[model samples]
Target: MNREQPDPPAGGDRIRQTAVRAGGDVIGKKVEHHHPAGPVTALHALPTPPAGFTGRDALLEELLAAVDPTTGADRAGVVVSAVAGMGGVGKTALALAVGAAARQRGWFCAELFVDLRGHTPGAQPVDANAALDTLLRALGVDVEKIPPALEERAAFYRSALAALSDRDEHRRPVLVVADNAAAVEQVRPLLPGPGGHRLLVTSRSTLHSLAGARRIDVDVLTPKAAVALLAAILGADDSRSGRTEELAEVARWCGYLPLALEISAALLVRAPHLDPARLARRLAQEGRRLERLDDGERTVRAVFDLSVQRLTPGQARVFALLGVNPGPDIATEAAAVLTGLEAEEAEEVLQDLAGARLLTSHPGGRWSMHDLLTDHARHHLTHHTGTEVEAARRRLLDHYTRLTADAAIHLQALPGEAVPATFTGTADALAWLDTEFPNLSAAAYAAQHAGHTDIAVALPLDLGVHLDRRRRFDELISLSTLARDTARTTGRTKAEAAAWNNLGAALAGVRRFQEAIEAHTTARTLYQQTGDRHREANAVNSLGAAFLEARRFEEAVQAYTTARTLHQESGDRRREAAAVNSLGLALAGVRRFEEAVQVHTTARALFREAGDRHGEAMALDSLGTGPGGVG
Candidate 1:
């Protein structure tokens, strides 16, 4: 190790004399100054251990093993372990406990701790130069002899640790804890030399840039642990002993986060008459949850406020826009459109936020914020940039609308038909639809809520076929109702007719035949008024199918005959063939066997002409079993 020892005064004087102009003993005399009378013993500057530091038994054991001096002696360098987690998860508490435990185990002869203040409210992080000065002073270097620049000070700090490690009389290492570091740069220079000294850093960020550091991620407490912590804070003789369920509910409202739990516990301790069940009710209201989380001094909101204070302008904009997203998670491309950023730029910003623990990245390249953090982001957007929220939500809805429309083409394709080449195939299209279905459903509702009725109608209309294919009748019914009401309110007659048809199909899927018939009848009437012949034929065909399923053969035959005529007039030969096939089945339903055979033959010819092999095969099968094929 480079022992660049501190040099004495340049004059080679063992003692320096300074004039004392106004002292009680000497008014105009020179006073001699000397170094401390004896050698400086090992320093102890760590804060007191956190009160009621419960749980995390496995994590504590693992961290202790990582820094055990006996195990670290095999390695030539100092051990650097970082504790990273979201704010209010107790990273600092864990670090402090580890430092104290290490000292008690005789793993180190001295302990030093400093708060980097990385996420402290209204405070900037302590720079590396300033941190090194603190560490050097604790290591027995005089303030006057400490170096000026960061590099020199770091070397001096390491050398002092090395000197302590090399001493035959006291060869144990020193335990250093750097708490609340915002970035890796703040703690990099504080690393000790290759002498087995240990450095433990606690931060809201993961600090991935620090090389060779063992990262221990801290998360929220388990439900049992959270309740245990509450009891610990409320004392052993509190009257709320039998109310475990209410206590658990309150913990659930706090999201099992340590800081929120601590604050809630403090509130109960201060107000002895407050009921735990009542507290749970107040926190169950999400709008008032954060308000109740405050104890007149510290708040969950203030803790989150500090986490976002250091974000760049772009990151801040994107973070605020996340509040407007209704889905539980957002894909990268979707977030890009919502934030008006390029896909690549949005990905980088998302990863940065993940590093800062503000967002969590999932397996499919999606990101999500914690429920409490999302509430804070929503409040931030409402107060800081409310004007852009509508635009951002509109952009997100439009993006889903376009993608859903594209996926619908594949869902509507026939068995022997080709889909659009933009999609790989039917399977790929289905996967995209499956992944985005939740977002699309949420977007449709959000559009209606935001008064964008056109998008609200278009989105569910486009998703109708997929919802039917997946047997998601409940979701289909929900969105269809929204679309139907939104269209009627906005005077969109054509969109309303389409929504009615979709609702009819979903109702038919669930065997609600009478309601389905009523929905299709209204749709047919609307199409007739609009002079849309092709859609009128579609509505009539759907009406015939509902009649056939309801076992009303005569009404089915009448609806199919009219539908066939409408399709012929519109020059939709495929739909005409479909109507003819349904007419044959209705003929057999009423026991007209020979008439059914003739009608099936004609339908087979039309299906062959239309190049619909699947329809033609069905027609031939109907011809083979003339009376037996009736519904």
Candidate 2:
């Protein structure tokens, strides 16, 4: 047994030796460890602010206060501020100004800027996912490491922002300026969670649904601010041309809107010696204002067109109608009338327009469009609205004509007048006319140009008495001229006669006696040719007034005599009373006081028969007072 143990021990030694050698071989292999590289530094990726950027100090301060990373130590999420307004209202300019200022103040370690292209003329808006991919690459993340899914990428982006803030020994901040963001979804994923980061978003949309965002609305520049901006753009030499009044006129014509002012200033710079007064004169024409406020690459109208192009079909139709609207602003009820929708339905469309920044809402449920936007809308009305524009124009004009005719009945009525059901009383009628006077004037001209001959003829005919009451003589003349031309083109004989009569009245109001006589003569001939005895009598009365104005007393007497006879034949007692009163004036002009008194006495009786108490009172006063007879 002793001999066997000794032999095994000797064998076990070799095995032990081999095991030791294997252990040594394993221990001999080299060992290695890896660690991640340090974070990137010095990121500066913001576009330069526009040259000569001026104004918006108050807005800049608000933006700076909202986006200041230093003040919100307890806050963890990124601060977001939305700058919104109509296109070309300086939202981008204000945003750029804030970004440049923040960068200069050393408030950020990295900066990012992107144009969302939400309202670009011919391009689609940039996808938020793709925009994130680009942003990740900019932040020094490897392209391969970026996740393929949008949600994953967005998660990774937030992590990266958190990691960057954490890794930085100095605790530097990041700034992002998202330009032209179309909607909330496009910007939601890009925002950083509670951290040392801030976002500034600028858009043509109000972006009201963007959660937790500080909203800033940009409006048209104040007149002084606008003029100063123009001066800044045009330089001291061009702006100080001893034509400050003209410069101010130019600013007003531009609607005190920045894009228009900038474009006009640029035009002035290019032409140098083109007097500001001349430019103002050109812009004074509303039809040509947009044309003059355009450069080759950019235009106020083009900018506004892009904003309109983004509207929904219903919203687009309303926008087009707004362009054709003749007033400075529109109430919800009036807008309803224009769109042929219920007031509530039209109000919803108006809210959509306001949200898109295509229209601005004022107090009292009213809305206004920018001057340039109106021009662009009109352009769309001409090209995009197609045949619907004609129907729309007719509806618009009919609404105005019917309402105005009703109002005229309360103010002053002719024979055979029918009141519109819309008018409840004289006060209501006058209030409507007062509110719609400007639009009524604009509708007449718009109808004439749009080839709505019937509307053109009816609008001025119904609105003329209101215009006369307001002493809007120039506008009256313009409406009358347009109506006359439209009536002639459409071969509406009675409309032509009415147009000529209104034109004669308007011309007389403006002291153009000779032109007034010609217009009245043409009206009389047309009315007589059409065998419209009542209207012919009215035309003859108008001709007699023109003769009296021209000091041709004998011709005035003859015209008034013919008008009185025609009114008697037509059984228009009211107009016969008016003609007799005019005959009394002509007789008085010819120094026949006794004949004037007799004529006035007969006129008073006719006025009473016609139930015109005011006409009777005027005739009584005329009979008592010699030189000032009423007609």
Model 2, 559-602: lDDT tens per residue? Answer: 98998898789776766787787688779888888898889899
| Clash pairs, model 2 backbone | 76-194, 76-195, 77-193, 77-194
Candidate 1 lDDT by residue in tens digits, 158-264 = 88887867773669887788887888899888878577788888877777788767777887889999888888878889977447888898777767777677656
Report the number of the highest-lDDT candidate. 1
TM-score, one value per model: 0.56, 0.52
Output the lDDT of residue 234, model 2. 72
| Model 2 C-alpha lDDT versus the unseen true structure | 0.66
Candidate 1 lDDT for residue 227: 88
Question: In model 2, which runs have C-alpha deviations exceeding 4 angstroms?
Answer: 1-317, 375-385, 414-418, 628-631
Which regions of candidate 1 are displaced past 4 Å?
Answer: 1-293, 296-298, 414-422, 621-627
